[model samples]
Target: MSELVAAEDVLLFVNAAVTATGQREFRSSAEEQRFSLGFLHEYVRVNYRPVYAAALALDVNHHNAALIVEGLLRTAGEAGGAEEKRAEGRLIAARLAMLPPQRVYRLFRALRAAGVNNRRTRAIVRGWLAARPDPALDAVKYRTGVKAAVRHVHGRPADPETGDFLFAPGRRVRYGNALLDAYRRAHYEQSAVYELPFTVAEGFAAKHGVPRAVFLERIAPRMTRLERLRTERASGAGAELAVMPLTRLALYVLALPFGERVGRRAELTGALRASARRAAGPYAGSWGRVTAVLDDSFSSSGSAVKRRRPLAVALGCHFLLEALAAPGAYTALWTSGGDDPLMVRPYGPTPLGTRILDALETEPERLVIVSDGWDNAPPGLAGEVLRVWRSRLDPGRGTSVVHLNPVYDADGFDVRRLAASVPTAGMRDAEDLAALVEIAQFAEGRTGFTELRAYLDRRVEHFLTEAGA
Candidate 1:
């Protein structure tokens, strides 16, 4: 991968992991675990300084953040240069001081394990502890133990008095104030904070009295990309924002509210085509004819948080694949009813099997389907259609069918497949779209865990080299 591509992937992974809120459960399936472990290991190992900063800046889960700090401290201790070692120690200490008391306690053991026995390191920890002592946290630790305190912090149960801690002396006070101010502005000024299922942050912009442009410039940087995109669209300010890079632009346009998209459809379509053309320049003639079956069903709009939906993900992939395919060789089949597939919106029910059968008529060399895999259409027709297409349509059966799912079905599966012979993969985000071709190989059983690890190692090396570390 190019340095730019590697950097983008790294940013995407960090954003996805760090900005995940408590309400969101990190997937622990074998595949997800492997991916997470590999990515975290490589990230910390390659770019310890910035990764540690991100963990603190994003205020990720205490345990995950502690792990990054531990890794950085360990690397710092092993460093041969005295200046670099001291600099790393100071950096870690500065970040640690800003974290909550509970998070600091969680890092205690890990710090010890990382050989934080030096005087400078120990003093930093002690100074931070003394400056921001939490009596409640101390009492909890005294009564139940360190583990219990850690659990309490992570659980984040409603503590009416805990609101005072927002202004209490601590490194988090500034961040806490910013959060409180934002919420206050969002609630009182805008009257927008509602308990809705599919609401986005932009839904509150009007009530908060903050223009969409200002929100994007001032507040959106602190948010995850998913949150920012959804909010921008919900505020009906998507078009007013500056044009994004190809992948992000595709997702942004895809997430725009239907009402807001009325007259600007043609302009947005042109932007997508332009983005695709630019993205396709690197590997001009490397791709063959491609057909994509996109599922924009009602379920694609479901979310754990009232944020962006999978529909945006599916649409981004559709445009990305279209751009990457050979000229006049790409076809998009929107499962949602429409005269023009590109103009179809996400709604109605999923018809996976029917769409594949329809796409087979075109006899494209490659097929990519984006969906949540909750096919509610009558009988599961995807498998039967795949069998038919292989048996009758192509004697060589060279057509590659890839099923990409955005949501992780916690029922013990990552990808839901239509046929055993076909490949199914997970499309975690827009960055992963760049690896669509490689992921398809995983579905076909051509790649395994070894290859995945090697890929991660290569990325790590590239990132580190790019950083001149």
Candidate 2:
């Protein structure tokens, strides 16, 4: 689990490093360098392809990039079948194509040193050498190649002009006068995939004079319930509510506009309880006393644009745990004031300590707290209260406390200031609540690098199987 977490962290770091705007101060260059070196060592030892791309992109350490290329060559040599070799070649080509000329030359040197004289490798090297030094042209060619590869893989039709498939909806054509023509066609026809970015979709909708109902019908199905609700609220298209799906009622209700919420409050609570009951049905006999403290503070509302995401995630966790617990063994406590129908409405400040104390009265064997890890009310008291409770009341009972954070901290730490003993797990999606046991294990240091690697390997195998390669 820690390894998976580390891999994710490394990926995030790579993304930041590759696209870092010099102004941001998330981490110092020294810290990033040190961490990148350590990560490269581990990743290269395992022949991880992502790390190779990142290492090459970093460009600051030529030696590290060379090491990555050597690792890739070694892995390629170890591959058994023709298909495996082809896959390895494609991966290497893709990575190399993305790098700058200097880094590509460095990679070529490493490949030559490693005696990697494959036809595909030679072809990639020749292509790079033949390409002009113009960055714009090089980028276009690279994207065209990528689109062609995607088309081949997905068996999609290729574009007549570029001989490339349109994998992304908002992709612009570079042929003479074709870009504007394609945009116009896309606007009127909605031929592009609905998975296009919100801004692009919004622009297209506005340009085409698409009605709110049409936009909701065509695009909302592709979006998550929360996303659709946000779009509706932002566009002042509340009337499109009739067309919106109620599959994720709890999340939908949490994300609804303030005015529209009054009428749906009762319906939302009922839906939440029903969903919880369905999820908990399987573990009917195994449930013990459980207390869940959900943070519904202002921070959980997220930004004005992506409102109620954290609250939705919290509600997801809340309902899942509620269903799992025995009828008389569960207690739900929200950070803000709410009684029977607990609406995950983020408005006030975080009073986590008080909520924890209130939940402790139930004497639950397990305590799960879902928040963004930004506790402010009676600041930093939650950790103290947990310590005092454990020390004074039930030291021998071994009560478990798990802190699940939905928001990623820019500072690189999980929680602000929680007890060291309390494990913190990231909640990237609402579905993550289903893995509560695994998450708890991760928090408690029981799930380690080996388990994480095994899980990742399994996923890779599954992908290959699904791809029929």
Candidate 3:
């Protein structure tokens, strides 16, 4: 393959790995997404193993990162060499540490189901379990997965009663651990249920015939941040937006009634801006003359599974870019011609092309388009506008244009791009916009694999340092 083709192949997998999570999208089924993603994983691992390993260090979502970890461990013997396997091993450990506890346990279940019983796999499982702050809680909270994982790896629980609770539930009359004792007592006592995590508490609450509202209120202290957000939304309590992620905050904003959004515009926008600043961190006020053409069209409503996800991503990117831009140098153009970002609902057809033209007239130094790239409000106008702007209007390429697509096109096996002239990257969250934009820039004529590798190397060092593994 040619150099450009090789680079393009890697970029294709990067985009797919970044965005496809085996979930339904605005135009694709979940099955198709899984099939396409699985195929890409195998193809990239076999053809570009190094890049595949390096991707774990990139801003890939936890879903794909876990998939990568499993794939590497499952096919351990196929690695290029000892050095490669060592590199992949470190990346796996670092990425595993970054994944949520539930996801890591789910991965263990998957490994057990797949019958991957290599010594290395056992070591990884043992190390992760050894690092747990409290294994007894895991046995109580995530009983099935933990039991299977421990048995599959032949692990011995630190607590003797915990063993009885998992392999032989009710075998022991009483337990020493408070959480385990609560689990045993919760079978009969509604008061004991409030001591457990919200999810585990729910089952006990149902068994004890406790009212949902009363249970939520009583278990408020034990609820996680996200659980509190959900319960508080229904209970008319103010959500703790100060601690929520930017994308999730946008989803919450979109879920609110229009009049409520209008009534609380200042509070909502302030929270978003504050969260965006945190995500931007040192990159704040870095991009100059930034313009974003955000798509909130009907298609951006996403799917039944991912309700208003694309719109949420766009909303997230808006505030993120605002924080990343030089003060007063950023402007947002909504495809639906909506000026109020707070009130942008999923309506009207995608007029991406019109938005592109309008953004271009503003003479921005950097143009970022957050769209699915259907661009059919006058089909192909966006591509033509880009073509003329790249070739005729500004042959020297004064303004940099990049498309950040949220949805993956399973039919194409990649994110649908607006034009060949402008580089495109798939983005899972607005928090990773800086990294994704840097990757997209490499796909343009400016840089290639060597630079990409250097970027990945830098990321790998930082990731491992942060992971301390």
Candidate 4:
């Protein structure tokens, strides 16, 4: 493939991997997402193998990262491939180190089921398990997964009790490991269940008919930050909402009853802005004369599974951009024309073309458009406006414009673009906005595939060092 075509192809796959989670979206079904993603995965793996392998370091979502690991191991494309097997192996190990334990275990199960028992695969699996700080606790909490992983890897557990707990349960009258002992006791005694991790205790709680409120209350001290944040809404206490990631916090704020949100506007909005400032970090107030055309249109309602995810991403970006702009140099225009971020909700057709026109009139030094790129208010108005502005109105390149799409359009094989002139990068969280802004230059046709590959190489090196892998 030509360098330009190759550059675009890698970008298309990167965008899909970053934003698509094989879940239902406002404008697409889950099956549609899967079929589209499957095709992209295979196509990139065969054509741009090295870059495809390099994506592991670029913060690809858990779903895609797991798939990448599986594909790499199944093919076992050692030394003779475009990227050496050793290098790819390091990427796989680093990515697995970053992935959730559940996903990594699931991936191991899949590899075993597929009959992929290569030496490298076994070593990778062994190394990951060796790195866990508390494998004994893992034996208790993730019993089935750890069991499968160990069985698939065909090794005895380091602790005899841990091995017996999986292969020969209740073989010992009392296990040496405290957590292992708790697992055996929780099977018979109600109070022993409380000693286990919250996730492990949940099943015992249900079996013993304990009320959810009581279980949650008792489990609060043992719960992780994210766990408490997740259950806080249901349990009615315990999470500092501000501690949540900006996108998640925005989604939570949007999920609250409108009346509750209005009544608690100061607290919620203040929390969002503070979180935004933290995410902005050293880059805070760095963008000069910035304007964000954020989409809060009805289509942004996302899907039931994703519930307001698109809108949440936009809301998060709005606050982050507000934090990133020079003092009094930022402006945000929601497509629905709402002035209050707190009051913004999904409604009306997406009038992106009009919003683009309005943003352009202000002549911002940087224009960041966060949208799904539907542009249906007047059919292609957004694209036309952008095309004209890029070619005619801003031929001298006076203003910088970049599109950050929160939704990936399956049929397009990429995040749908408002215009070829405005570089569009898929974004799942606004926290990634600053990094993606620099990454988007490759999509702007200013660089070729070689430079893009170089960029991925740098990311891989840094990712390995930072992960201390």
Model 3, range 189-279, lDDT digits (tens) per residue? 8789989988999988988898887888788889888888888865565678877999999999999899999998999999999999999
lDDT of each prediction vs. the true structure?
Answer: 0.55, 0.56, 0.89, 0.89
The local distance difference test score of model 3 is 0.89
Better by TM-score, candidate 4 or 3: 3
Give candidate 4's total backbone clashes. 0
Better of 1 and 2 by lDDT: 2
User: Using alpha carbons, what is the TM-score of model 1?
Assistant: 0.54
| lDDT digits (tens) for residues 124-235 of candidate 4 | 9899999888988888777788988888888778877788888888578888788888877887798888888989899998998989999888878778877887898778
Error of 2 at 180 (Å): 17
**lDDT string, candidate 1, 1-469, tens digits:** 3443444344334433432222332233444544554455456457544433333333233444566666665555455477656645555565666555556765665555544655555555555544445533443223223333323233222332333332232423222333333443444554323311122345676555666566555454345445555576545444422245554665566556675466677777777666656555676435688888888777665454523446666766776777778878988888885545345565788888888888877777888888766666855777777767767767586787777766554333234456656766555554355555563564454454455445555644454444343
Per-model TM-score, in order, reads 0.54, 0.56, 0.97, 0.97
| Predicted structure with the largest TM-score when compared to the true one | 3
Which ten residues in a row are the worst by lDDT in model 1? 191-200
Clashes per candidate (backbone, < 3 Å): 3, 0, 0, 0
After superposition on all C-alphas, the RMSD of every candidate to the true structure, in Å, is 11.9, 10.6, 1.4, 1.6
TM-score attained by model 4: 0.97
Cα deviation of 241 in candidate 3 (Å)? 0.5
